[model samples]
Target: MKRLCTLVAAVLVSTSLTLRAQAEETINYITAGGIYLENIQKAYLDPVGKQLGIKWSVETNDVDTPVRVQVQSGAVTTDLVEFGASTCALGGAEGLYEKLDYSVIDNSELAPGTFSDYYVGSTIYSMVIAWNPKKVPNPPQNWADFWNVEKFPGTRSLYRNAFYVLEAALLADGVPKDKLYPLDLDRAFASLAKIKPHIKAWWASGAESQQLVREGGIDMIGMFNARAQSVISDGGSLAYTFNEGLIDFGCWSIVKGTPKKDLVMKVLAEFVKKEHQADMTLLSNYGAANTKIEETGKIPADLAPLLPTSAENYPKQIVTSAEWWAKHGAEAKERFDQFLAE
Candidate 1:
C-alpha cells in the first residue's frame, strides 16, 4: 500500500511538470502601449516567437493598473510586461514580478542600473523638448531655456507625472544635473509654478504627446524622443533636442505567478539581442538596451548622433535615479497632486 501511494505521488508530480511545460508554449507580452507596439511587434515579438517555436500574443495596455490588478487577483494573464524602470522597483516591492533567472537571461549586454533583480532593460528612451520649428526657430537648448518663456516664447506641454517635471524644474532653476537627487521638491515645485500657466496641456499618454506636436496645439512640448522621431519620420513638422532629456529604460519583467517563466525568459533573451535591439532602434529611434548595438554595424552613421545613449548627446542629459524615486515616489506624487490642485 505504501509503495502504491508513493508511485501515485510521483506520477502526479510528473504530470504537473508536463502540463506547465505545455503552458509555456504560448507567451503573452504586455506593453506600456502606443506607437511602440507596432515596432515592438515587428522587431522583437514576431521574430522571437518564430525563432523560439512558441506562439505569442500581445496586449496594448497600461503597465501599472492592469498589472497590479492581475497580480493581486492571482489571474495573471500576461507572461511579461514592458515596465518603466522605476515601475520595476515598485512592482518588485509589491511582489508583482518574478525574480529574474540570470542563468538563462544574459546581463552583460545591459548598461548599469538597467539590470535589476526582477527585470532587465529592453530599450533606452529619452524625454526631450519636441517642437514645430516654424513656431520656434530658436530652440530651447537646455532646461534653463525651456523655462525662459520671454526668450523662446511658446505654449508648452509636459507629462502629467511628477517624475520628469520635478527634475526639469530643478535643472531649470540652475541645479547642476550631477546634484539632481535626493530631489528638492520644494524648489522644484517653485520652478514649476513659473511655467505652469504656460503649459497648454498636461499630456497623459505617448499618443497624446505626438498629437500635440503634429496638430500644433502647443508650440513646443516636453516629449518622448521616439514619439518625436515617429512624427519626424512621417514628415510632420517636428524636431527635438537632447539637452536635459531624461534618460530611462523600458525593461521586461515576468509577471509573478505566471506558469510560463521558462519560455518568457527565452523571449527576453531574443528581445535583447544586438540584432533585435538594432531592429527596434531603426524603427523607433530608441537606443538599444544592448550596448553592443553600436558594434553590430546595423545603425546608419547619420542616425548614430541622435540616440539618447550616443556619445555626443549622453552627457547633455541626466540619468534618472530609480533608487531615489523608488523610496520617495509616493510622497512626491502626493505633494505634486496637492500642488497641481492648488
Candidate 2:
C-alpha cells in the first residue's frame, strides 16, 4: 500500500511540474499602440494566454525597424509583430519573417489572398472621402468629385504619404480603375495641380485627419475609415463614402528565428478566430481581416458600411497592390514631393 501511495504521489508531481512549465512559457508580441493593441489584448492575448497556459508580453511599435535590427543582429526577442502590407512584403523577401505554418495557424477564416507564407492579414483600413454633410450638401461621390473644386467648393485635406495621394490623383483624372497600376505620374501630377491650392491641410497622421473633420477644420478630405468613424461617432456631422476607396491592410508575422515558433503559430490562430476578430472591430473600428466574421452578424448594421472588408464596401474599392508599390514607390514618391514643392 505504501508503494501504491508513492507511485500516485510521483504521478501527481510529474503532472504539476509539466503544468508549471507550460504556464511559464511566454511569447512577445509587438503591435501598434492605442485601440488596436488594447482590443488585441482584451479579445485575444489575455484570453488565449489563459486557455493555453502561456503568457504573452505585449509591446508597441509601428515601424519594423526593431524587427529588422533583431534579424540583422541574430538575437531576436520579438516572437510576433504587426506590419503594414508593404513592409511585410519587403521583410518577407529579406527573410526577416518565418514561413507561417498554416496547418497550425488556420487561414481559412480570413479573406482570400489575405494570408501568405510569411504573413497573415490582421486588419483592413481604407482611405475614404469624408465630408461634413452640413458643409457640402452634396458630398463628393467619388475621387473625381473630390478633385472637382468648382462643384464641391471647400477646403480639402489629404494624406502626406505619396502612395495613396498619387492613386487618388490618377483616379480623379479619369484613369480607369482596372488600369490604375503602372501609375501615370505626369497625369496624376497634372490632376493634383488643379486641387493643390484648395488643399487646406496635408495630414500626416490619422488623428490629424479626425481632428480636421471633427472641428470643421477641413470641409472634405481623404481620410482613414477608422478616423472618420471616430469623428462620426462623436456626433460630428460627417459622412464618408467607400466609393473609389483605397484599401490598405496590416498583417501579423513571426520573427524568423524565434524559439517559440510553434507556440506563436498557435497564438496567431487565435487572433483570426471569428469571435476575436469581431471583437477587435468593436474596439478599433478597423475591419476584421477574417471574412467569416461578417457572416456572424455581430457587427452592427450601421457600422458594416464603414468596414473596408465588408461585402458591399470591399467590392467597391481597389485593394492597394503592395507588390507594385514595392517596385515603384520610391520613384513615385520623389516625383510627388517635387510636385508638392513646385
Candidate 3:
C-alpha cells in the first residue's frame, strides 16, 4: 500500500505539470504596439507558443490604461501585461497585480528588484531623434542638423528632462562629443531659444512620445529608439538616428487574477533565458536584460554595431554622466524651468 501511494503521488505531480502547459492554450498578452509587439512575437510569443503547443493573443496600446481598466473590471482579458516599474508597483498596491512566483520565473541573472511581487524589467533603451523621412526627406544627422530648422523644416518635440535637452543644445552649438561632460548651461539655453518656438511639445514620458509619433503629432521628435522603431513598424511614419541618444532602463509586469496564471507564468519563465533575451536585442535595438548576453556572444558581430551599447554606436551617442549631473543637475533644471516660463 505504501508503494502504491508513492507511485500515485508521482503521477499526480507529473499530471500537474502537464496541466500547467496544456491549460489555457491561448494566453492573452498586452503591451506597447509597433516593433515591440513584432519582436515579442518573433522572440517570445511565436517560439514559445510552438514549444508549449499553444497560441497567443496580443493587444497593443500606447500605455497601461487598458491593462489597468481590464484588471479593475475583475476580468482581466490579458494574462500578461508589461509596464515600467512605478506603474507596476501601483498595479500591485491596488491588487491589480499578484505576487509573482519566483520559483516559476528565474531571477538569478536579473538586476535586484527588477521584479518585485509585481513587475520585471527585461530591457534597456535609448532616446533618439525619430523623424518621418517622408515629411523631411533629408532629416537631421546630428544635433546641429536638427537645430537647422530652415535647412530641415519640421515641427519638433524633445524630452522634458534637462539632461538630454541641455546636452543636445550644446551639441547643436558645435560642442564635441567628449567635451559635453560639464554642460555649458549658458550656450545650451541660447541654442534652445533659437528652436523654442518650433518645439511642438516637451514630452514628459515614454507614453506621450509614442502618442506623438503614432498620431503624427510632430514631424520630428526626440524619442526612445525602440518606441520610434515600434511605431514605424506599426506604420507610423518615423525612423531613428543615433547621434546623441540617451540610454535608460524600464520594467515589465503581469496582471493580477488572470485565470491562466500557470500558463502566463510559464511564458514569463521563458523570457528569463539569456538566449531569448539576446534574441530580443536582435529583434529590437533595445539592449537585453540578460547580463550574460555579451559574454555569451549571443549578439552577432554585424548586429552589434546597430545596438545602443555597441562599439560603433557608443562613441557617437550621448550617455548622461551621473557624476556631472549629481552636482549641476539642480541649477540646470532651474534654468530649464525658467526658460520654459519665459
Candidate 4:
C-alpha cells in the first residue's frame, strides 16, 4: 500500500510540472484598444518573449472597467496592460496593478523624463493646433495666437475631453507653464466659456478629430498629433503646431493578483530594451520611452522632430501629473459635465 501511494504521488508531481511548463510557454499582454497593439506585439512583445524563452499573446482593450471586473472576481486574464495615465492612476487606486520591479527593468534605459515606479510611461502624445494650410496662410503658433479667431478667423474644433481644453484655456489666458497646476478652476471654466460660441465641434475620439480636420468640418482644431499626422500623411490638407500643446502620457503596468506574475515581469524587462523600444516608437510615431535609443543614433530625422527625445523640443514640453489627475479625475469630470451642460 505504501509503495502504490508513492508511485501515484510521483505521477501527480510530474503532471503538475508539465502544466507549469505549458503555462510558461506563453506570456499574455493586454494593450490599448486599436491597431496600435499589432505593432507593439510584433515590434516589442513577440521578440522579447522569444529572448526570454516564452511565447507572447497580447489582447487590446480599454483598461479600468474590464480590469476592475477581472481583479474583483479573481479572474485576472491580463498579465500586462498599456493604458492612458489616467487609467493607470485609477487602476492603482483600486489596488489592481502590481508595482513594477525597477531593478530588473532598469529605469535608466528609459528616456530621462518618462519613468515612474508603479508604471512606466510608454509614450508622450499631445493636443496641438491642426490647420489646413491651404485654408489658412498663417497657422496659429501660440495659445494667444490660436484664440485669436478674429485674425486667424475660421471655425475651430477642440477636444471634448475636459483635461485638455482646460489647459488650453489657461494658456490662452496667459498662465505660464510653471504655474498650471492648482489650476484656477473658476477662471479656466470662464475662459472656456468665452470660446464656446466659436467651437464648430468638440471632438470625442481620435478618429472623429482626424476626420473633422480632413473633411473640413472645422478648419482648425486642438487635435491629438498622432491622428493628425495620420490624416496629413494620407493626403489631407492638415498641418499641426506643437507650441503650447497639452502633452499627455500613456503607460504600461502589470496587474496585481495575476497567476503569471513572474512571466509578466520578465516580459516587461524585455519590452523596454533599446532596440524593441525604438521599433515600437517608429511604428507608433510616438516618442520612444528609451533614452539609449535617442543617444545611439537609432532615431530617424523625420521621426525625431515628432518625438519627445530631440534636445530642442523636450525641454519645451510639460509633463502631465498622473497622480494629481487620478485623484481629481472623477471630480473634474463631474464639474466639467455640469459646466458643459450649462
Candidate 5:
C-alpha cells in the first residue's frame, strides 16, 4: 500500500510541472527600437503579459533583414514583428508573414483599410511641411505653395526616401488628390528638379530633420509631424501645416512559419484593444490605428486635430498606397537616384 501511494504522488507532481511549463510559454517579438518600442512595451506588452500570464521577449531592428534571415533559414526565432507599410506589403507579397487568422483576431475596432490578411496597422504618422515662422513669416499652406520659392523663399530640407518626395512633387505639380496614384513619375521628377537647387539638405532620419529646423540650418523642411510637435512643445519658433500632408503607418505581422501563430494572434488582439491603442498614442504622440479611440474620447480633444486620421485633417492629406509602392517603388527609386545625381 505504501509503494502504490508513493507512485500516485509522483505522477501528480510530473503532471503539475508539465502544465506549468506550458502556461509559461514565452513569445519573441521584434520592432523598431527607440521611444516607439518603449511605449509599446509599456502600454501593450507589459499589461498583456500580466493579464494573459505569458512572457514576451523583445528585440529591436529598424529594417526587416533579421526577419528575412530567419525565414530563409527555415528557423524563425521571432514570432512577430512590426515594420513600415511598404515593408509589410512587400513582405506579405513575398509570403514572409503568416496569413492572419481573422477568426481568432478581431480587427473590427481598427481604422478602415488599416489591417490586411497578413498584418494589422500598429500606428499612424505623417510627413508635413515644417518651417521656422521667424524665417518665413508667411508659411506655405500646401505643397504648391511650398514649391513657390519666390513667396516662401528659404533653403529647404526633404526626406531622402523616394516615396514621400515623389508624392510631394506630384502634389506640387497640381496632381489632384484622387489622381495622385499610379504616379506620374516623369512630371514628378520634373517638378522636383525645379526645387532641387533650392534644397539645402536631404534628411535621412526624423532626428536630422528636427535638428536642422531647430538650429536654423534649414528655413523649411518636409518632416514628420511628431518631430514638428516636439519642436512646438519645446516652444521653438517653428510651425507646420497639415494641408497636403502624407499619411503613413506601420503594421504588426506574424512571422511566416511561427509555430506559435495562435498564441501570437491572441496577444496581438490584446495589444490593439481600444484602451491600449489610446495609451500607445499618448505615449508616443503617434495616432492610434483603432478608430474606437476617437469615439470613446480616449484621445484628448486638443490632440485629435493633430492626428493624421482626424476628421478635420484626414481630407486635407493624401493617403499613400502601400501596394502600389510595393509594386513600382524599386523602379521609381532608381529613377529618383539618377535624377539626384544629375
Candidate 6:
C-alpha cells in the first residue's frame, strides 16, 4: 500500500507541473508605436525573459482603443502595457489598468516614487522645438520665437496631436507657462490658425517628425527629443531646444484582469533598475525614468542640447499637466480638428 501511494503522488506532482507550464504559455506585452521598441526588446525582453524563463511577445499600436475595447469586453489579451502620459491617464480614468501590488517587486534601486499604485514610468520623453541649424543659423530659442515665422521664414512641421500643440499655442499667444493648464481654447486655436498654412505638414508620430528633419524636408518642427537625438547622432544636420518643451513620460501598466499580473510587475521593477534604464536610454536615445541613472559623462555635446534631463536643459523645461490634459483632451481634440478643417 505504501509503494502504491508513493507512485500515485509522483503522478499527481507531474500533472501539476504540466498544468502550470501550460498556464503561462506566453507573456503578452503591448507598447506604443515608436523606435523605442528596438531598444526595449534588446535591453529588457531578451535578457529578462531568459532569466525568468517566460516567453515574450511584443505588440505595438498607435492608440489605446484596443486596450480599452479588451478591458470593456472582459477579454484581456494584453498582460503588460507601455503607454504615454495621455493613455495612462485615460486608462486610470476608465478603470482599465490593474491596481499594482508592489510588494512582489523591488523598486529600491529606482528613483523615489517612480512606481505608482497603478502604473510605473518606464521612460522619459519630451515634445520640443527642433530646427535645421543649416537652414536657420539663428534658430528660435523660446515658444515666442518659434511663432515668429515671418522673421524665420521656412516651412514648419508641427505636432498633429491635440494636447502638446494646444498647450504650445497657448504659450506662444502669451499664456504663462505655469498657467497653461485648463487651457484658453479660443486663443489657442487662433494661434494655430495664424500658423496653419506655414506648416507644410503636421507630424503624426515620432518617425514622421524625425524623417522631416533628417531628410532636410522641413526647416522647423515640433518633435520629440528622442527622435531628434537619433538624427543628431547620425551626423544629420539637426538641433533642438529644450526651452518650452512639453515634458512627458511613458509608463508601464498591468491589465486589470490579467492572470500574469505578478509576472508583469516583476518585469516592470526589473526594467526600472538604474543599470537597465541607462542601457535602454543609450539604445533608444530616450531618457530613463529612473532619476538615479548616472550619466556616463559620454553624451554627445551636440545632442546634449536636446536631452531634457541634462542639467542645463532640465531647469528650463516644463512638466506636462497629465491630469488636466486628460480631463480636457477629448474636447480639445474636437476643437483642434475643427480648427484644422478651417
Best by lDDT: 5
lDDT of each structure?
0.86, 0.86, 0.76, 0.77, 0.87, 0.79
Choose 1 or 3, whichever is better by lDDT.
Answer: 1
Which digits, one per residue and each the tens of the lDDT, describe model 2 over residues 107-177? 87788767788889988889999898888998899999999988888889999878789899999989999
Per-residue accuracy of model 4 over 1-342 as CA lDDT, tens digit each = 999999999999999999988865765667765657767777876687667778767676754677788889989877778888877877877688998888778777775546565677676687778888888888888777778879888889888877778878888888899898877778888888888888888888777888788775688888877778778778888888677767777788888888777777777777777877778777777766776775556677778777654566667666666666787777777888897788
Candidate 2 whole-model C-alpha lDDT, 0 to 1: 0.86
TM-score of each: 0.90, 0.89, 0.60, 0.89, 0.91, 0.88
Query: Once superposed on the true structure, which residue ranges of model 5 sit more than 4 Å away at CA?
Result: 1-22
Model 5: how far residue 328 lies from native, Å: 1.0
Model 2 scores worst on lDDT over the 10 consecutive residues at: 32-41
Q: What's model 6's TM-score?
A: 0.88
User: Candidate 3 lDDT, tens digit per residue, 303-332?
Assistant: 675577666775667665544554676688
Give the C-alpha miss distance for residue 252 in model 1, angstroms. Answer: 0.5
Model 2 alpha-carbon drift over 4 Å, by segment: 1-23
lDDT of 1: 0.86
Better of 2 and 5 by lDDT: 5
Clashes of each: 0, 0, 2, 0, 0, 0
Candidate 1: clashing pairs of residues: none
TM-score of 2: 0.89
lDDT of 5 by residue, 1-342 (tens): 999999999999999999988888789989977667788888888999898888888998767899999999999999989988888888999999999887887788888878998889888988999899888988999989889999888889899879899999999999999999899999999999998999888888777888899884799999988889888888887898889999889899999999998889898888778888888887777887888876656678888867777888878888898988889989999998898889
